[model samples]
Target: MRAYNETWIENKNVVSQAERWHRRSLLTDDQLTAVRKAYPVGFQTMNGFLEIGLFIFTIIATGGVFLLFVELLSIDDSSIFGLYCLLFGIGLAILNNVLIRRRQFYRNGVDNALVMATTALMVGGFNSQFLDDGSLWQWCLVALPLLAAVVWYYGDTLITFIALAVLYTCLFDLTLEASFGRTLLPFVGMVVSGLLMQATRMIRQRAYYDDAVSLTQWVALAMLLVSVNYYVVRETNWLLIRSTLRRSGVMSPPEIDLPWLFWLLTVGLPIGYLWQGFVRKNRMLIILGVLGVAAAVATIRYYVGILPLNVHLTLCGLFLIGIAVGGIRYLRSSRYGFTDVPDEDSPDEFLISSDVITAAQVAAGTSGHDQHDNVKFGGGKFGGGGAGGGYN
Candidate 1:
């Protein structure tokens, strides 16, 4: 076997792109040479973007193929198009199976890309076959579960995150009539996610459920962040009234959108999550809390852009720099409230818990940057907790 530096592998786990790429600052000349020659990470390479672009192209290409197939069949009926969805979906699924079963690991990007395209086809086909009523809630009911099965079979975190997003958004849409559910969902999400996080800990204590742990943690943290961030973006009363009107088509009393209440939710709730993170020494909690804080700031910026853009950028930049320094200082100190008891089978999940993996990085000074924080309201797929392996 050819020797290569694994430092890049380790360094890529650092979330900040700066930290991952500027390895020359830390490594010696020999190590740098090794890093340069080493194979790029599967999901973390610059090629990921190229792969994404190609994946999108593939979806479009697949749709065109579906259309061409329909044309060849000469089916003039609009309803017959639904049949096309079924045909195309099955074809894609077959291809996905073949690629996964037969292809080399070097072509995982192609496999994963095909799987994503397959998901779109399957969803469209299922919806066309059954959801003739054009109800989003109904479509979600049919589609989310199927997509969930894809996630399980594929074992992809990205897919898992997507499913959670679909579930959350659809539930939000369905429950908008009650101001309480909308308000409570994300809060409920936080608690539920925290429970999930605790479950990861238990799994780690016993067996270190590599893929399962990573998937669970990323999902939980994403849930926590969504819960905390939603509380601030808008008043629940607005959603309540809108949903009620949509559902009933009646002369319902309008609920007022009180700005004052949102001000508290937008600013205070994140502080609360942050405080809870500090209290529990929960890394995901802290990371979500930080994201919640950023979301709050974004909410404020959206509602109140009183300052000039440059000044806004400058202030935000300064604050982030301070936060980075403060966080590093805190973690380096034994006062690191985010301490986990020394365990052999710890830190197995995706990088955030990636069920998101920052606690290990930000607190314990470890790096596993396979975190999937860039997603919200998605299509779930994963690859066993960003495991570093190639198809042999």
Candidate 2:
């Protein structure tokens, strides 16, 4: 189902676990090296800065070549231009596949850039060539399947986000055109987002798909909140209604139906998310919950301006600081598998200092038996550790 090598993916996961163990001081330097040598990952990757630089470079290079081709051919017609774009997109897609299969590029900038360009070109070309009088929703309908296919093949997080966005746009536009659409749109969005959230949650966890699935789930959660958010519902409804009224030559202020229901959702959804976050101990949910709360506050301030913006912001900041300080203090002792203390075993910590690991490895090699004797063995989240086969 995936384009990348399965064995390499498994090896990459093993290496990740080994790195975590080494960071936690549960794996000896020698053991870490042994694990690395035993399970090798062939995927070509880059550091964050390099990846971004290469991504930009790839886009620029490809765009330049495309423009040069268009200039040389002197293609001016929309149909011809669309045909060229389709050809270019197909070429890029093939190149992407070649890079992945032959060079084992995974999340590397070249592959990422190619996939993105391919998607954009294909969608643009299709719209230009085939949909002369089509609506925006119709265009989005065309894009949704292409984006979904790209996501399934590449499992790119950004592509997944684009796919979700297209899906949302399609739904929104379609629903807005229906009978009683203004009244039903928000609820429809809520229902679809809720179903999407559940679907993502039930997907079988795999290394290749994990990031995409997580991103989809997060987007679904956000969409669900936005669907019921008072400001969003009211503003969007007003805008649509205003447009319709302008078309009909009727200038009247729009009023939302069931303002009370929207208000309840605006206040209640955030609290629900916050409670669910704490209960599930999900960091993404907690962060979204905090944002939801901010949105709710903003909505209130938008409608009813009792306090000044600066005063409201200052109070919110102070309240947040107080909560953070109190929560940290409360979680200092580590209750219910949660703590204020940072995990030494975290993957982020592992990436921070390769030199430290090298120095420790050198010291271990020099001290030999003494270092082995001094090594601590204990129960860890990974397993009872001494690096022997704990990672295995």
Candidate 1, poorest ten consecutive residues by summed lDDT: 383-392
Position 87, candidate 2: lDDT: 96
Model 1 compared with the native: what TM-score? 0.57
lDDT at residue 61 of model 2 (Cα atoms): 97
Taking the tens digit of each residue's C-alpha lDDT, what string does model 2 give over 155-219? 88789988988998898898888889989999989998999988887888776776777777777
Best by TM-score: 2
List clashing residue pairs in candidate 2. none
Give candidate 2's error at residue 115 in angstroms.
Answer: 0.7
Q: lDDT (0-100) at residue 310 of candidate 2?
A: 77
